[model samples]
Target: MFIQNALPQKPNLWKYIIGLIVVVFFWRGLGSIPLIAAMFTKASDLGSIDMTPAGLADLLGANLFLSVMLSSFVLGLIGLFLYVKFVHKQSIRSLTTSREKIDWGRIFFSFFVTILFIGGFLYAGVMMEPDSYQWNFNKEAFIILAAIVLLMLPLQTSFEEYFFRGYLLQGLGVATNSRFWSLVITSSLFGLMHIFNPEIQKIGYAVLTVYIGLGFLMGIMTLMDEGLELALGFHAANNMTIALMVTTDWSALQTDALYVSSAEPDLGGMLLFLGGMFVVLLGIFALRYRWKNWGNKLFGKALVLEEETTA
Candidate 1:
């Protein structure tokens, strides 16, 4: 597969470790510097970044916060790229899949599919509150904003997926000598990382069941498919839909997206999220991707690598 070719024919454990640390320093540590400064300066509380466009605008204006957040991601990207290119000595494409190149088809297909799915929700919102919706259609600014959001946001989401599900999943799998452990660890960490999200506070801890469930879904898809394509598509679509379709008083990302929605989230409880997740999992299984040794895959031990060589 194209992804296989992208990886180091022989894994280099040291490079992976160093690269992860480098990524964390830049993407996370450096990224938080601005927020930290703001906290100390009393410029603004961290929780102020809201779901509305105006709220997003305020946060973006904070140079330190923006610098740290964006630079950290860039740093992480560079670190991962270097690991893939030099340590693994593999083409960028192989890192994602065994494909020779990025399958624009997969990306677009997922994009459109997600749009259609979320578009349904948007339609419902509009139907419910026709007067509440308004289009601030400035051709030029809208175009630029759309481009920026679509391009940059997807990169951000993809970075998360690659790092957590792809790189971390593989590394942990090799380290623990068990894919199951890797999946559990990766998914758990993924969900835990979002504990600080503003949405949790707005909607309550019940919403986190959805977040963690979503993480598990993404991670499981990666493990079952033996690649990140499906998860990447699903995640990009999910985020893009959220970005473009809705805006609320209490949500995480604030962007000048296409549609400004005012719908209070109904699926704000654990039971709803679990039910939704169960449905999605069933659908995936219906598609016949649920392979043999199911019990082992979800919670089995990972394969251990030799100490001397990870290749």
Candidate 2:
């Protein structure tokens, strides 16, 4: 039923694939414009600015750098919009959910739950190692950072959620005719997308394990719930809380956060916290929604090739 939502749209397989490629190419190319300008400004040479996250942060200034990157996701959103509107001949609503209307309740519930969940992690870490963090708050800068985050963070997180859990999840399910493969493929891609983040450079590739794990959890939420609401809410909350609460030289989002962590990441603690939080969040959703059909929802082959061919 999830992938079948695409049936009425009559999508062309090749067009969907090619269109995404074109959109991403253009969108990413445009995001590079500011970085290009920064390079020239910094050393009077086009290639002077190193392409690392920290390098860009140094050259562009933290706030301007983040604004530029977040704006690129807005472009990605537009590309996805163009594809759904013209190429797929479908409404964004269908891409979002199987329900008659968007589920704001699920979104809000997941959002608040994630805030508390991650808030706990931060508190525990601080309690355990008080000296590891520095209060980085500058009230004027924080107000400015919060303003930017409130406005642009949603666009950044939503762009990723819609593209991954919504658009690509649905697209792959329909393309492969198998929801299980769809979930795995999209989640892997989601993880790999962050492989180039500054965290990888700081903490090494082990952090990718955490990224991929989070991907699977979000993918599970989307597949089992038959909507992007939970995934979108949880992701938005995750990023928003981090952007507001903390930052590090090694983190992907090196913003003017309230607290800055000076210690290297505890890989084991990171995994444990992520895994534990994921299970707890899943439990909350399971009980509240009374989710059923675990064997089928998470792993069942929903779109058989022959069945789709016949249909």
Global lDDT of each candidate: 0.62, 0.83
Question: With candidate 2 superimposed using the best TM-score fit, by how many Å does residue 214's alpha carbon deviate from the native?
Answer: 1.0
Specify the highest-lDDT model's number: 2
**TM accuracy, model 2:** 0.93
Candidate 2: list runs displaced more than 4 Å: 38-43, 304-311
Tens digit of per-residue lDDT, candidate 2, span 200-258: 77778888889888899998999889998999889989998998888888777878888
lDDT: worst 10-residue window of model 2: 300-309
Overall local distance difference test of candidate 1: 0.62
Clashing pairs in 2: none
For candidate 2, what is the lDDT? Answer: 0.83
